[model samples]
Target chain A: MATGSFATSGADLELVGIQKRFPGFTAIEHLDLVIPAGSFFALLGPSGCGKTTTLRLVAGLEDPTRGSILIGGEDVTHRKPFQRPVNTVFQSYALFPHMTVLENVAFGLRRRKMAKPLELAQEALELVELEHLASRKPTQLSGGQQQRVALARAVVNRPALLLLDEPLGALDLKLRRQMQLELKSIQEEVGLTFLHVTHDQEEAMTMADTVAVMNKGRIEQLGAPEDLYELPHTAFVANFLGQSNLFTGPVLEATSHAIAVEVAGTRVLVPKARARKHSGEVTVGIRPEKLRLLTEAPPTTAGVNTLGPGTVTDVSFSGVSTQYQVDVPGADSVTVFAQNLDFGPVVTPGTEVWVSWKVDHGFGLEDSASEEAKFAPELDTATIAVQAKRDLAAELEVS
Target chain B: MAFAAFATGTAKEQAPRRKSRIALLLLLPGILYMMLFFLVPLVSLVMTSLQAPVEFGDIGEYETAFRWENYVVAISTYGEHILRSFGYALMATIFALLFSYPLAYFIGVKARPWPLLQKLMLVMVIAPFFISFLLRTLAWKSLLSDEGFLVSSLKALSLMAPDAHFTGTGAAVVFGLTYNFIPFMTLPLYANLERLDTRLVEAGGDLYARPATTFFKVTVPLSMPGIVSGVLLTFIPAAGDYINASPQFLGGPSTAMIGNVIESNFLVTNNYPAAASLSIILMAVILVMVVVYIKRSGTEDLL
Candidate 1:
């Protein structure tokens, strides 16, 4: 659909075995990705997870140590940033401070010697709804306004792909939420391959059609947001995408359709399709929201897993949901998020409760040692998981 | 009286008042110093600029009279010297800016990855300050003398006439001024460029600007404040400099500037009124030029 003049059919971007290394560390370790034209794709990860590095490699700001980058079957690996048909909306919204908003928007067009730069820039400003602030310098505008100008500046070029490196990071919570929807709509309106890099999982889930969970310079999982949230392949993906209550156990029996795993002296069945590793040891995981917290022991139902009859250690009340931490005898403390559907007396600390979930909801992760060997050559999985958890905790605190 | 009222008032209400009193008290010494040193001398100089030579008195004697025509005589007698001084200063300022912008960019932006190199280069830029300015100018005088290695080599290479020389010329005096004020121009530019956000340059490149285009459009415009300050720092003192244009230094009598004229009038001819009027004119001209320069640069809001 011809929504506006800025709409142009975009070309797909491909990164073939790209690797980037700094002086003492490797930022990206063999990244291979292909973003389809006109798709909203997000590289979701914690800080320092190579997501931004990947974006920069595509933008031609940094050269890959070992592989080629292609845009629409053109090898642009050795080209300069200006020679490549890519533009970036930087995390700091690096608009030229000396120029007015219109001038900043027209910068790329003017550099390319395009016709009617001012008209195109004004149209782009109107697209971002900042036409009234055209004559004002960048410093005169607020952070959100500057962010819009940066977006308009990059979008006005109609590059093959648009790179957004945490573009909403500088905005407040309210403004960030508002801009997330606006950015998604703008992507659709322009129909360009938009590659967004962010640490906020919620932003990635809400804005992108496909989210690639990245960790420790590798892609942990790539799929639709719902699929990734429902069936994570690694502990990093399961814990980082959202809170996952994981239990390390050995596989007692494996069948074509299911695997019976013994977790904390209790048998839990996982669907064969959901478990990445069905034979040896595995870490079974279930989302906190999927598990139910009941005061009595759950009945022995087929195709169900129950893990508690334990004491409630803590209770936290947020507006929409109440979070309960239950301590079972065999398992460590488990987190359960209960919806605020009941108006009765809230559950207090030191009360007994049982945590239960359907077997279909459980997804199994391979043993940590093997997972570590698969991703990194030297380090173990514990260190990466702890780092990811710390980063996620810091991100949560910031939000 | 205000301090006494503050002390006697209620403690809660008078605390802010007492603090303000202390702040004013702290400013007393600076105010006294300015009044005694700057304002008093400025007023005396203005008075002297308007004074007349004593009637039928000795050469050095002058009387307190409103002879404003002393300024007219000063300008008429040394109009060419005043023009040459400004022209040399403008040339020196432009040359220093051209030399320092790249040096500062290299030191502040390119050498940033190796901070030790950045610091080392900055120290090198300011290292010439350790020697006395007069001694340095005198050294340059010898280096560009008729028989010196530079002139001799140029003559041998057929690049200059056999009888040509470097000293006793406008170019030599301008070169000396430019050399002496280079650090002044470089440091401010370095500080400004060091604080510039390099991502903006990268953004320029990402937006289809070539490297040269990015340097001109993104880097230079953002460093305008530095350019303006460096120009002022170099031009103001270069205009009033006497050492470079003194007959014993790099220049002859034909190439004398306003500073040398004022010096000779006060020392040799004992024309105190002429010297004082020329000094006042120099100050007024510099003030007007600086105001216009700052206004044209559009950095008045920064100050």
Candidate 2:
């Protein structure tokens, strides 16, 4: 694991210690975020994880119970939504049913007391490629077209920050993809900071320059999409962002450069930064794509510290990749995803194989004292029992 | 083979036979009722309005010669009453709308606990219905009388003298009409305004529109269907209502509406032809007003 120094910079809008509490629940808790200007930022999380609440706080639709929201280094926490230089494209699009498309886009300009509202509205409609449908009502347009109308309505105001709350949630899958690219390009062309809230991980990873993964009313991690994917700081991020095969172990030795640990009765070495000091136990994390399977045991390569003999328990072909679940010694199953690049012949189920990966591929975590921690003592026992049962059943079937 | 073919053909034609019988059965009772009640009565009313009087209390009076002059006399005699009825109806509609709009908007849009407010409003609307129409009108009369509680309150406030009178005047009649019909106006407006998509309002506010601008641009225009219905309900009933403007109530000859004239001509004066003619003309005027209103408001679908 390669570690980088923590530094906050290039943020135009900063949310400092933001907190919001509803009657019986705290929707957000001490949320600190810095959104860089001219960046497409996404607040990605599960449902009811305060993603929408954060967006609403920034939009001034809801006030924070204890925090300040600063836009471009000026405090805007007390300002009304209309008073702030920000606009929102609501999830439902919320186009006025009583007005034509042109009028809907022109509404903000008219309210701002602009001299040439019609001309501005026409230009906006043209930008969204909705000029021909200007005379039609919102109900007359398709879902995608209505989404464009909403985008046009928000962009016409020329605000410094544009907020979008699941604007493409109503579209079909193909249309959603198209609109995602369009939204990204539009944000680039306008050179405005966009704060988008969505629960779709792929949507966030595809469009946003930076993704903030939130869980349980807190930001779990915030970084570039690729960095977050390659290096997740927690087990939650590892599982949430993509798939990971985790291993439990106890650290035997530690240094500034590397740490040695025993995982599933086998000695393994991992980077020092990945090892957190704890009483006895730690968790080892490895991406499935990094593991390799070989039919015969090979000599250990430099920096490759862990190898184990296992039987292929399950083999599933997923088009571009093939996933293998290997049942290793001490009753642990590790998954490995191998690219299907005509790699000789595929391994069959119940085949004996050796799985190995580099030391840097595995990151260690401190054994958590919390009850709700993912790697509990009972989970290890359960895995051992299930693996023993499966091995016995397979032996009997083979006999 | 020929007999089997004929049997198949007959089975295919059996569905139409059952359908034809059902269609005839459905039409039979309605046709009989229309002929016996509606068509016969309409033809007799037209014929009776045309007949001249032969002898008083004679059954054959309607068989006399057709007298077209009766319509002319009816109009010349009761024209003022017809005009007063229309004027009162219009005034009542305007007043009801003025009072009900804000109340409906507030209750429908601004009220947080909407179910409770809706139940309360429903109770208020049906409260008058629980009392007899005449009893409600009489109650209004008592409230507007010279020595009524309202007049006394005004006198106590030094806004009026102790002897301020409201009975037997056009204002009292209009007030009675408005009070009776206000709920009719409110319910539809509340229904429509409550069903209004609040997102549209929020969208307007997000676009930097003030509350007032949103009300006019989105709220009012979307609620036109309700407004038109309320106007129709209040205006039509208030115009045709003689009970509220009768002499037994807070009304006089100056406050007598077209319904009063129709009632007196038919019951008191025993002038059936003139009464029928006046009724026809009043119906025509109301029909024309409804047509004009529907076309102007572009809410003909609501009708």
Model 2 Cα lDDT, one tens digit per residue, A27-120: 9988999998889999887667798999888878889999999987889999876666677999889999878999999888888877688788
How close to the true structure is residue B65 of candidate 2, measured as C-alpha lDDT? 57
Model 1, residue A120: what's the lDDT? 93
Quantify all predictions' global Cα lDDT against the true fold: 0.87, 0.80
| Model 2 ranges with Cα > 4 A deviation | A1-11, A274-280, A305-307, A329-333, A343-345, A365-399, B1-51, B55-76, B112-114
Lowest summed lDDT window (length 10), candidate 1 chain B: B1-10
Lowest summed lDDT across 10 adjacent residues in model 2 chain A is found at A1-10
DockQ class, candidate 2: acceptable
lDDT of 1 by residue, A1-399 (tens): 111233267778999999999999999988899889999999998778899999988888898999999997889999999888888999989999999999999999888878899999999999778999999999999988999899889988888788999888767888787778877877787788889998878888999999998888888889999999998888778777777888877899998999998877899899999988987788889999998888888789998899878899898988788888999887788999888886522679999988899999999886452354454432223455577789999999999
Q: Which residue pairs collide in model 1, if any?
A: none
Which docking band does candidate 1 fall into?
A: acceptable
